[model samples]
Target: MGSTGDSGNGKAGWWCRRSSSPSSSSTASSSTPSRTFETRDPRTGDVLAHIAEADKADVDIAVKAAREAFEHGKWPRMSGYERSRVMNKLADLVEQHADELAALDGADAGKLLTLGKIIDMPAAAQMLRYYAGAADKIHGESLRVAGKYQGYTLKEPIGVVGVIIPWNFPTMMFFLKVSPALAAGCTVVVKPAEQTPLSALYYAHLAKLAGVPDGVINVVPGFGPTAGAALSSHMDVDSIAFTGSAEIGRTIMESAARSNLKNVSLELGGKSPMIVFDDADVDMAVSLSTLAVFFNKGEICVAGSRVYVQEGIYDEFVKKAVEAAKNWKVGDPFDAATNMGPQVDKVQFERVLKYIEIGKNEGATLLTGGKPTGDKGYYIEPTIFVDVKEDMTIAQEEIFGPVMSLMKFKTVEEAIEKANCTKYGLAAGIVTKNLNIANMVSRSVRAGTVWVNCYFAFDPDAPFGGFKMSGFGRDQGMVAIDKYLQVKSVITAVPDSPWY
Candidate 1:
C-alpha cells in the first residue's frame, strides 16, 4: 500500500498518514485511545478505512504548527514567485494522481466515479492553478498623495488560518479555502468534515510532496464541534474560512468574536430557485433543471431545490422533468454509466427521507418518486413534487437531496417574489429567450450567482458566495485574496514635523 510517492510515511491505500513529526506530548496523546471513526462506502455500507477522530488537544497541536510556520518559517516571508512555483507543482500532482484521488473520493463520499474522475477532480486542480497564477500578483500598492507624507497600502498575509471543509465536495472545498490562503502566504490548519476526511489528509501529503513546507499545510481529521470549534476559538488563529450550513456559520462567527476576533469567511447552504417562463425553451429547461438538482444526487450547495414555472407551462414542464428524471441511472458509484449515487451517510439519508414525509404532510402533491430505492446503501429515488406552495417546509428549507419542489407562478413578478422568499440567497437561475426578463430578474433576485438561460455555470474567475442568511464573503476569483490578506497603510514624513 505504501506508494503515492513522496508521502512522509509512504503508507498509502485508504489510510492517510500524519504529515508532521509529533511532539513527545503529541506522541503520548496519540496513544491515549481517542475515539475513532470508520469511513464506509455509501454505495455498499462496507468499511473503507478508519481515521483517528481529533479533539481539542489534537486541534491545538495542528494550530500551533501552523502558527509557527506562519510566524517563523520561510514560507510567509518567501517571494511571491517562489510560492507560486510550489502551488503550480501541487496542481501538477493533482493531475498526476487523478485516478487514485478520484477513486478515493468515490469510496469515501459515494460520488459517482465517472463524475469524480471526469469533472470534480479536474476542476479542483484547475482552481488550484488559477490561485497559483495569482500568487505573484499579490503586492502592495504605491502611493500618490498631495501631502509631504507618502502613504501606501501593504497587502500582507493574515497568519495561521483555520479551514473547515464540507463533505459534499471534499476535494474542491479543500482547494477553495487552502489554495488562496497559501497563495497569500498564510499557513493553514485544516479540519475536514468527519464524513470525508480521507481526501483532505491525502491532499496534505500531496502538498508536502509538491514542496510546501511541513507545517504550512496541516490536516487534522475530525468532527465539527470539537476540532472545528477549537480551531475557530483558538487565540493563535488569525482567520477562519468555512463552507457549510447557515446555522453552523453563526456558531463560527460567535466563536471568532469571543476568541481573538479572527476574520471569518463563510459559504453556506442554499434553497436556490430555478425559474422557467412561458416563452422559454422547455426542453432546455427540463435538461438543465435535472442536472442542477440531480447532478450529485442534489448534494451541491447551489442545487436548484425550488423550481418555479409559469402557470401556462407548469403542467408541461413537470411532465418532461419527470420523464428526464427517469433516465438518471442510480446504482454502484464505481459503474461507468451511473449518473446518480447514494447519499453520503445514514444521517443525511434519514434527513432527506424525513423531508419527503414533510412534503407529504404539508399538502404538496407528489408527482413521482417519493420512496427509497434499495435495501442496502443509503439510496433514495430522485423525488419530485408539484403544486408546492412557497410556505411549505419542503419548498422553504435547504433540502440537500435529489428532491425538487415544483411551484407555479402567474407572472414574472410572482416568480421573483416566491423565489426570494427563502432565508437562503446562495444561487438562482433564469431560463428564457427574453433578454429584458433575464436582466430584470438577474438584477432583482438576492443571490450570489444568477445563471441566465443556464444552470450551475461556474468559473474560477467568478467570485461565488451568498447574501443574507446564506453567509458572507466570496470564494474563488480575485476577491478571495482579500479574505486571506490584511491591508496596512504606512505613512512617512518627507520633511521636518511642524512641532520641530
Candidate 2:
C-alpha cells in the first residue's frame, strides 16, 4: 500500500494494496505496468483492491465481445423464458454469496456492511428476480387497421448496450442495469465508476458461475474519460444507460451523437427537497428527514438534501433535527453499530468541506456538525445548516455527502414554490397528515417520485428517473426495459386483396 498525494479522483501516484484477479470476469490480457490502478478504503485511506485499469483498447475488447454476444450468441437470440432460466439461476447465486458480495461492497465503496448485507445485496438479487419473472411477460400490442392491412407492433431488443454506473451503490446499480438489459435480450458492457469496482467485477465472476453465456455481460473498470468514453462512442453499441452528474450526462449525449447516435437514458443530479408541514408529526418528520439526507452518508442520488419546515414548528424542528444528526454513528463501514461512514474518497471529502465553508460564509447557521472528524480517513460529521437561502450554493448544488440544508416556509403554496425552485427534479418528500395537502403536494412537485409521508421509498416495481436537468429515462419497473427495446410496426395485406 502506497499513498503519494494522488488519489483516483483525477490525480495520480496513490496505490492500492489489495490484490484481485482481472480474470474474475474473463481472460484479461496483460497490460503495461503504468496503465493499472487501485481503489482505496475511504475510512482509513488504505489501499483496498488493485484493478486492471482499462483504456480505449480494453474498451474495444469488451465492446467487441458484447457486440458479438448480441449478434450471434444464444443470449440475444434466446426466448424470454430461456433467458429467464439463466437470470433466475443468477439470482440464486447472488443469494448464496450475499455475505461475500456485501463485504466487498462495504470495503470498496465505504457502504455500511449492514446496509449492503440487509438492503442492497438482497435488493440486487430481488431485482434480478423481478426482471426475470417479467422476462417472458415483455410484449407489444396489435393495432386495429380500418382499411385492408392487418397491423401489429413487435417489441424487440436494441442489441448491444453500454451501462455506466456510479460508485454510491455499486452492487445495486450493477444489477439495475444488467438485469433489465438481459431481460430485454440485450448484451451489455458495464463500466463501473473507478472508485468502486470490486463488487461489479465479482458480479461478472458470479455470472460465469450462474451459466450466463460468455460475452453476454462484460465489465471494464477504469476512469470515466478513458474506458467510459470509449464504450459510449463505440459504433456497435445500440444504447447507453448512465447515472451520474448532469454535466457528464450532456457529454455522453454528445459522444453518442458523434458516434452511432445511440439511444441514451440518464439519471442525473438532484437537490431533492423534503417538505414538513406544521400539521405533520414533528418526531416522524425529524426521523425521516435525517434518514433522507444522512443515510448512506448522503451519497444517494435521490437523497432529500433540502429540508423545508413550516414556521409554526421551525425552532422545534431545528432542535430535533440537530439532535437526530448527532445520533448517526460515523465510523468504519464494517463496524456493526456504524450508521454513517466516510466520504467515498478524498475528492468528495474536500468538496463537502468546501460546501460547508461556503454555507458558513453565506450566513447560514451551522447548527450541528460542519467539519471533518477523523485523522486517518475522509470522515465528516453529519452537518446541518439552518436559515439556508434557496440560492445558497449548498442548497442549490448537489452535495453528494452527509450535509443537510434547512429552510422555513409559511404556507403550503410557499413551500411548493420553494421546493420546485431548483432545476433538479429527481425526487421529493412531504410529511403531513392532511390528505388534501399530501395529495396536492404530491401532484405539484416537479420531481419524478414523490413520497407523501415517507422518504426514500423505492421498489423494483416503481419507475424512477429525473424530470428536468436531473436528466430523463426510467430505471426500474417494466418501463425500464422499454428503453432498451424498439417497437416495430408490421403490416400485411388482408387476403392479398390490395395491389396498389
Candidate 3:
C-alpha cells in the first residue's frame, strides 16, 4: 500500500543505479520521465521500489558491453586460475552480505527469510564456489587419430552469453546460470525477472567489487516481452541460458533459430510426481511428500504436485496429507516460524485461485484449503484435492501454487504409467524401501532426475535438466559449463611421420 523506501536506501536497501555502460556506479537521469515499473512486496501488496524498465535499447547496450568484454577485456583473456580467483572473491562477497541478500529476496519476492538465508543465499554462494573450483579444470583432450598426425581438442568460451532468469528462486537462479558461464570465461548479460531484480543488481555490484572487469557481468532488470525478447534474439549473443516456462522456452528457441542460431539451454516447467509405495514409512512419506509440493509455496519447477500412493496406503496417506496441508503455515516471509509465503503477486495469486475453482468444478473433492487467507497480501491456503482423474485439469496442468493432487495407484505399473502421463519430465521422487521397486520406477520414469527416498535434493555435482516438454540442457555439474563452451578440433600431420 505504501512505498518501503528508495531503491538505493532506507528499509529496502537494494541498489538500483541504471546505466547503459557496464559501470555499476553510473546512474540514469531520474529527472527525465522514462518507462518504469513498480516492483512490489508480495507479502503486503506494497510497492517496494520503482524500477527503471530496460527495453530493446537497453538490452542492445548490455549485449554490446558483454561482446566487448569477451573480445578485448581482461576477463576472457585471463587464465583460468586468474578467473577462478576473481569468481571465488565474488563468492566470498556473497557470503559476507548473505543476510542482506536474503532480505532483498524476502521483501521483493515474498520468499521466506529463513529459507532465503539457509537454503537460497548459501546455495548461491556454494554454486559460485563450486564453479570457481571447476574453472581451472576446463581442459582439452589429446586425441588418437587414424593417420600419423598430432591431434587435440580445444575447449573455448562460447563468447557473450545472455541469461534470462525467472522470479522464483531469483538469487539461486542468478548464480546457477551466471556462475558457470563466468567459469567458462564467458562474459554475461543477465536480465533478471522484473518481479524480482533486487538480488541480481546487488550481485552485479559484488562482481565489480571482487575485481571482475566492468563489462564482464551486466544486470539489466526488465519485463520479459521487451528486454528478455531482445536478449534471446540478439545476433551478437553466442548463447542464451534461460530458466522459465516451456511456452517461453519455445519462443526463445524460435528467436535463436531466426537470429544467429545462438546456443540455447532451458530448464523449464514440471508437474513432477512423487510415488509413495505401501512399504514406505507413512509418517516420513507424509512429511516429505507435503514438503515436496508445498515447499516454496509450490512455485518450484520440480514441485511434486501430483503424488501417487499405493492402494494399501491410499486412504491413510490422503488423511495425513490433508492434515499436513491444513497445518502448513501461510504468513509473512519475515516470520521465522512461517514455512510458506504469499504468492509472488496478485496475478500469481489469482492464477492459483482460478485453478482451485477449476479443480472444484472438475468434480475433484477439496479436502482442505481451497480459499485465500489473511486480509491483505497474496496468501492462499495449502490446497489438496482427491478423486483427481488422470485427465482432470488439476492433474494435467501445472498449477504453480501450494496445491496437491493425491491419486491412488494399485500397482507399480499403474504408478509409473500415471507418472509418465504428463508431458513434463523435469524431476520426480520415489519413496520405497524396496530396492527393486525404487530401481524399477527410477529407471522407468521419463524425468531427468529421480530421488529414491528424498524430494528436492539438489547438489552442485549432480546434473539437472528436463526430458520432454520440460525443456533440455543440463543446469549444474561439469556438463553445464560445457554448454557455455565450444569445442575446436586441431590436427596436424606429424612432421617426421610416414604420413607427412
Candidate 4:
C-alpha cells in the first residue's frame, strides 16, 4: 500500500513511501536520501516491494522522534489502561487485515500462507493483546526498614528502545519487541531486516490506524550496518533489543558499550538438537524430527537441525525421517496445499547450499536431497544427511535452511552431551515414552526451551529465550517486561527514623 519507486536523484535506490513525498514548494533540500532495498519473492523472483533503506541520518531522525515521543508525547505518560486500549485496538486492526498481511508475508518472505494465517497472524495478534493486557499490571514494591520514613517503589520505562528484528518471522518479532516496549511506555525505533521489511512497513500503517501516535513507533528498513548499527549505537537510544545471529549479537553489545551503555537484550542463534531414545515412539519421533528440520524450510532458529538418535533405533529412525522428508511439499507458498517454501533470499539459499557441500566434503553421508530443485526462485529440496560427525560444519553451524544432520548416540548421557555440543542453547527436543528418561534428558540438556514431543510450539503466556551463547534475557510472558523497565526500591521505617 506504499509507494514503491526510486525517488532520489538516482544516487539512492527505490523507497516505499507510506505517504506522498512532501510538495516541492514545502522544502528545498532533504538531508536524508530516499533509497530502497528491493525484496524479491523467493518462489517467483518477482519484485515484492522496493523498500526504503534508512541511512544514518534517517536513523537519527527516527531515533530522535522516538526519544521526543518517550520524553514528551502522550504515549509515554498515558495511563496503563489507555495504553492497553490502544494495543488491543492495534491487535484488532491486525486481525481485520490478517488475510492481506499473510499474503504480503508470503510474497515477501516465501512463508506458507496457511501457516502465516493460522500460526503467525493469530499468534502475532495474541502477542499484542497479551502485552497490552500487561500494560496496567506492571507494579512496584514497598520495603520496610528500621531507620527510614515510609517509602514505596516505582517501576519506570527504560526510555527510547532500539529493536533489530530478524528476517524469519519479521512481523512476529516486530510485535514481540514493539508491543512490550509500548506497553511499558517506551518509544521505539525498529530496524527490520532488509530481506523482510514489507510486513513491518505494513504493520506501521496498521499501528497508525490503531491510534499509535506519529513518531511513537518508527520503522527504518535498511541494511544492518546502516540503520541497525545506527540504532544500536545511537546516544538517544536508551536500550537495544535484537533477534539475530550470535556474531551480530556480540557486535550489538560492543556497540552498546561504546555508545551510551544502553540496556541490551539479544535472542541469538541456536544449534538445537532432537534426541530420539530407543524407547521413544518411533512414529512420533520421525514425524516431529521431520517437522523440526523441514518446517519453515528449516529457517527457524530452533530447528532441530542436529538429530541424535539412540543407536538401537537409529536405522529405523533415519529410514522414517527420509521418507517423511520426501513427502514434504516444497513449492509456491501461496498454494494452499504447499507445506514448505523457498529460502528467504539467495544469500541464505547459497549459505545453506555451502553447508550441504561442507557436509559432503566432510564425509557426512547425504541421505536425501543435496541440490537446488529449480532454476527460478531460490528453492532447495528438503535435505537429510546421515552418518554426520558432531564436528562437521553442517552439524555445528546454523545452516538456517532445509538441512538435517543425523548422528547416533548410545545412551541418555551421550545424547545430552551431543545435544549440548554446540555453543548455542536456544532450544532442544526429546522424544521418549519413559518419564525417567524424559526427566533425566530434560535436566541434562542445556537449552532455554525443551519440547517433549512437539517442536515450534509457542504460547503468548510462556517465556521464550535462550541460554549460553544463544544470548540472554527472555521474550513473551511477564518476564519480557523486565527488560523494558528499571526498578527502584523504597524503604519504610518505624516512628523514629535515623536515616531518611
lDDT of 3 by residue, 24-68 (tens): 453343221256777888988988766767778767766776777
Give per-model CA RMSD.
Answer: 4.6, 5.4, 5.0, 4.4
Q: Write the per-residue lDDT of candidate 1 for residues 1-500, one digit (tens) a residue.
A: 11122233211112333332233121222222256777777887877666777778767767666776777888999888899999889999998998989888888898988878778888999998898899989878888766677878999999989999899999999999998999999998888888888788778768878888757887777778888899899999999999999899999999999998999999999999999999988999999899888888899999998989898888899999999888777888899988888999989999999999999998998877878888799898899998788888998889899999988899889889998999999999999999999999999999999999887778889999999898999998999999999999998887864532
Model 1 CA lDDT for position 402? 95
Clashes of 1: 0
Which runs in model 2 stand beyond 4 Å of their true positions? 1-17, 20-34, 496-500
Say which prediction, candidate 2 or candidate 4, comes out ahead on lDDT.
2
What TM-scores do the predictions have? 0.93, 0.94, 0.94, 0.93
Candidate 4 regions off by >4 Å?
1-32, 490-500
Candidate 2 collision pairs:
none
Clashing pairs in 4: 13-36, 14-36
The Cα RMSD of model 3 versus the native structure comes to: 5.0
The stretch of ten residues in a row with the least summed lDDT in candidate 4 is 1-10
Better of 1 and 3 by lDDT: 3
lDDT of 4 at 29: 17
Please write out the lDDT profile of model 2 over residues 1-500, one tens digit for every residue: 11111122211122223554434432233322246687988888777767678788767766767776677778877889998999999999888999999888887788899878889988998999999998898888898877777889999999989999999999989999989999999988888899998787777767777878767787778898898999899998899999999999999999999999999999999999999999989999999999999999999999999999999999999999999898888999899899898899999999999999999999999989998997789899999998799889999999999999999999999999999999899999999989999999989999999988888888999999999999999999989999999999999878765632
Error of 2 at 75 (Å): 0.6
- For residue 142, give model 2's deviation from the true position in Å: 2.2
